[model samples]
Target: MQWIPDWGQARIESMVANRPDWCISRQRTWGVPMSLFVHKETQELHPRTLELMEEVAKRVEVDGIQAWWDLDSRDILGADADSYEKVPDTLDVWFDSGSTHSSVVDVRPEFAGHAADMYLEGSDQHRGWFMSSPDDLYRDEGQSALPPGTDPRLYRLMARAARCPSLSATPFLRRT
Candidate 1:
């Protein structure tokens, strides 16, 4: 992958080599829900998780995300609702952003079965989106996220711009 600024490649390589595995779940009021059912006592996923998730997906497609929140556990779990509880955690922002290849880019009719050609991200994303995106792509497709010959670039915020008045309302970057 091609990165702007010669040092960017090394910086990203070092972060990837040293960073810890990211946690992909968080308890948040907003953001994509995990929509999982776990055993009340054991906290393990329900045995029929794939089937249940498909059911949830069908509902979500028709009614949007609020359908999951409004749904009663019993509606999906039947009598097992007493033993299985819905997981309230939402996916981490990094995980959600990282999976955009499959979730967004790859779903496009023109781009089916292909990876994105470019990924524009902030320089700070080396330890966040940069790492997570590649990892997710590799896990799902068994290859690096960037196709051969693709260029990946990161832009850093200008220090002076960050200190400017709030009226600017945008982080200016010093593109190299």
Candidate 2:
């Protein structure tokens, strides 16, 4: 919740400038419905039917979206059947991105314990995945980048010596 930015006036300007028309229609039958309604006589979608949609969403979480779809007119419009009919379009992109990690990685045990040695990206990554991946890695490892009680400066020096043993050798060894 704290992650959500309050854009306020900036949000309105951004929306006005970048608001491309979104195709709300989808051919899918699964997942959350678009929560619109069409008039039976006029064959046009009703604009004010989102009030009923909020009520339907509460029921969907408990009983599933199919329950709303299969409901009679009385239940669909909740006592206002003359004005509206439920929209059948559900978002296809919902399943596309929603289950990415689970669908791609978790099902294959080979990938389960594996991790990327390094992630190469443009400078944009400094603000994007690079910032987030470390937090995820730390959470997965159950500790910080260095183990508890280990000084990072000392660890780096040790690592450097480990990689270049000549630097760690004594001057007396030069005679040999």
Candidate 3:
């Protein structure tokens, strides 16, 4: 963040420090389910959540979201299905989209690499999608995604290119 404005840095820092517990599940008819399996007695994730996640993903890849909506846990888990519970809750909007960088971008060869040469978002997302990025990347790779000296150029994506545009081509705000 050496190049980031001081106030921008501070604002994001504040939001990160006060962030709330994440909710990765939702109740909805149209969305991807969280694909989490829980121990029937403890309400904890099954020991093979990752495997189950992949199984669900493979089915989704072939049949689309309906694969999850129409799944029969017993067919996948076999006898263990009686001991674990498949959560029907869909992923929260934020958790689903916020994970795209890791899930989609990182795994797909064509999209693999730095998320972007420049990452720009409104101040409002500091605590939501933008803030979730660092931890999400680190959680998977054991290090922050933004390598040192490779900090993304922070800028706001403005809605316009210029103002008083009836006469001039000059932008209303140009970088100094």
Candidate 2 Cα deviation (angstroms), residue 151: 28
Error of 2 at 34 (Å): 1.2
Query: How much lDDT does candidate 1 score?
Result: 0.74
CA shift of 120, model 3, Å: 1.2
Model 1 segments more than 4 A misplaced:
140-142, 145-149, 153-176
Model 1 clash pairs? none
lDDT of 1 by residue, 19-43 (tens): 8876789988998888899998999
Q: Write the per-residue lDDT of candidate 3 for residues 4-109, one digit (tens) a residue.
A: 5557777877787887887667788878788888989999998888998999999999999899878998978899999998888887666655666566554667
Rank by TM-score, descending? Answer: 1, 3, 2
Best model per lDDT: 1
Model 2, span 1-176: residue lDDT tens: 11112332244345445646545357776765677778887878666566767777778778886767776767656556776766678754523332233333445666554333323223322333333333343644476432333221111124445467454311011110
Candidate 2 accuracy as lDDT: 0.47
Task: Identify the leading candidate in terms of TM-score.
Answer: 1
Query: Model 2: number of clashes?
Result: 0
- Full-model lDDT for every candidate: 0.74, 0.47, 0.67
